[model samples]
Target: MHLNEKVIVITGGGQGLGRAMALFLAEKGATPVLIDMNSQALEETVRLCHEKGVQARAYIANIADEAAVEEVFGNIVRDLGAIHGLINNAGITRDAMFIKAKDGEVSKRMSLEQWQQVINVNLTGVFLCGREAATKMIEGGNEGVIINISSISRAGNMGQSNYSAAKAGVVALTTTWGKELARYGIRTGAIAPGFIATEMVMSMKPEALDKMAASIPAKRLGEPSEIASAVAFILENDYFTGRVIEVDGGLRL
Candidate 1:
């Protein structure tokens, strides 16, 4: 479908892949409704979209909170009249091994707080946003698309039990929602990205980052715009649903 004036809601639209997707969609003539917990960053994203000659609005809300999500989505429906697409792109990681051992004795273990925090934001947040978006689309009789952002680490990465499990669940939700929502004219898909050069990833030591890039077949970190392009493809393709597009530079895990 032509993106002209289409209303697309993007979670975590403040930065990284979310920001890139928002800007790209804006450039394509879509109106992006951006959500982020960081108000300043979200405003900056809105400004950037405006510069692209698109109508974009920013909302500061924690997606994991059911009430907040419900209210924000209600506001969108009230103001925008219909939602054509939604990108469940918000996520966070608290990396830690399930169990840490020292001298054959238990040293530290991944805390419940760490596990719950990641699950709440990464997994539950997606669920909340997806559910609300689907409801709005169905009510509006809008044939819409929902894109979930998974990670290559969903395959089970070391020191990322929580994040891996949550991301894997996201993939499962993408397929399940696709099957259930197809009859309603809503499609669902996922993008499992490899190491992207986001601010958080770039914050690592240069040598470590370079080693990671060397391991990938592409020999370079993927850019946020690459992932944004994948999002556009999914939205534009009507027959694509219930599957994952891995933009991982041939990274196996």
Candidate 2:
């Protein structure tokens, strides 16, 4: 699907990978429709897109809320006339061991709240937004693409049971939606990113960051633009569906 003039919805478009994607698509002539809970950041991203000389708009909504997701997509189609793509990039991390023990005595465990919060936002949010976007795309008679942002942690990281589970579930949804939505001219894909230099990651201690960089075969963190490039490749490639592209700087968990 050519991005020119296409209306693309990006969840978490306020910053990080989402912002990178919005700007990249804008550069390619796509109209970016940003969905984020951060009003100020959303406004800033929209302004940046405008500076790129492309049409852009921002909606403050929690993708995890079913009603909000439905209403937001409805409004996008109502206002934009159509939606050609959606990027499920909004997610959160709640890192905790499933069970933490010291000297055979249980010290702590991942709280149910932690598990539920990550699942609600990372996995369920993707489902809600993807469903609404596909419905709108079908009704508008526009072929569309949905991209889910998974993570290398989906393979299971030591301190991130919740995050890992949610990200892995995202991939499962991508595969199922790819088959189910294909008849409606909708394609589904996922990206599993390794450690990227986003605000959250870069905020880590210098020693920790150095250790992380050393662990990756590339000896560095990935730039947000590299992940954006993968997103663009998925958007532009007609046959790339039901698959995940990894942009992890040669890092594997």
TM-scores for every candidate against the unseen true structure: 0.98, 0.98
Clashing pairs in 1: none
Per-residue lDDT of 137 in model 2: 88
Candidate 2 residue pairs that clash? none
The residue-by-residue lDDT of candidate 2 on 1-253, one tens digit each, is 9999999999999999999999999999999999999999999999999999999999999999999999999899889899999999999988888998999999999999999999999999999999999988888888999999999999989989999989999999999999999998999999999999999889999999999999999999999999999999999999999998888888878
TM-score of 1: 0.98
Off by over 4 Å in 2: none
Give the Cα error of residue 211 in candidate 2, in Å. Answer: 1.1
Task: Write down the lDDT that model 1 would get.
Answer: 0.94
- Candidate 1 — which residues are off by over 4 angstroms? none
Candidate 2's C-alpha lDDT?
0.94
lDDT (Cα, tens digit) per residue for candidate 1, span 16-94: 8899999999989999999998988998899999999989988888999999999999999999899999999999989
Superposition error at 67 for model 1 (Å): 0.7
